[model samples]
Target: MIGVIATMTVQDGNGPQFEAVAAELIEKVRAQEDGNLLYQLTRSKADANVYKFMELYRDADALRAHGTSDYFRESFGKLGALLAGEPQIEYLDGV
Candidate 1:
């Protein structure tokens, strides 16, 4: 399995738009991706503009597929405009 944790900082006043885009992307991923074990979006209580994505995939191929998906590309393009800075991403392997 593969795990990924991505942290995103949204620009001020862009949280709502970011969340809306994220919601749609999540829905598409859940409905279309068979190898996605889990995909969750979380908001920080201490910082409303900070968000985290918890993702689990079946394998490396699955992870690659998710990254290359048209939905992901499109959503990310939309998300870029709302971000305060580049996202921080971490990839992990199961112990």
Candidate 2:
């Protein structure tokens, strides 16, 4: 199994837009990606603008598939404008 944690900070006044787009992306990921075990969006309690995508994949192939997915790319492209800076991503191996 593979775990991925991606954190993104939204630009000022862009929270709603970001969440709306992310909601669509999450729905697509869950409905279409069989390799995906978990894909969720979470907001920081301390910082409303800070968000994270908590994800789990079936394996390396699943992770790769997600990376190359057209919908993932397209959704990120839409989210780019709403981000305050580059997203921080961390990969982990399941114990």
lDDT of 2: 0.95
lDDT of 2 at 19: 95
lDDT of 1 by residue, 1-95 (tens): 99999999999999999999999999999998899999999999999999999999999999999999999999999998899999999999966
Q: Which candidate is the best by lDDT?
A: 1
Q: Kindly give the stretch of ten consecutive residues in candidate 1 with the minimal lDDT sum.
A: 86-95
How many clashes in each candidate?
Answer: 0, 0
Summarize candidate 2's per-residue lDDT along 1-95 as a digit string, tens digits. Answer: 99999999999999999999999999999998899999989999999999999999999999998889999999999998899999999999988
Superposed model 1: Cα runs more than 4 Å off:
none
Tell me the TM-score of model 1: 0.97
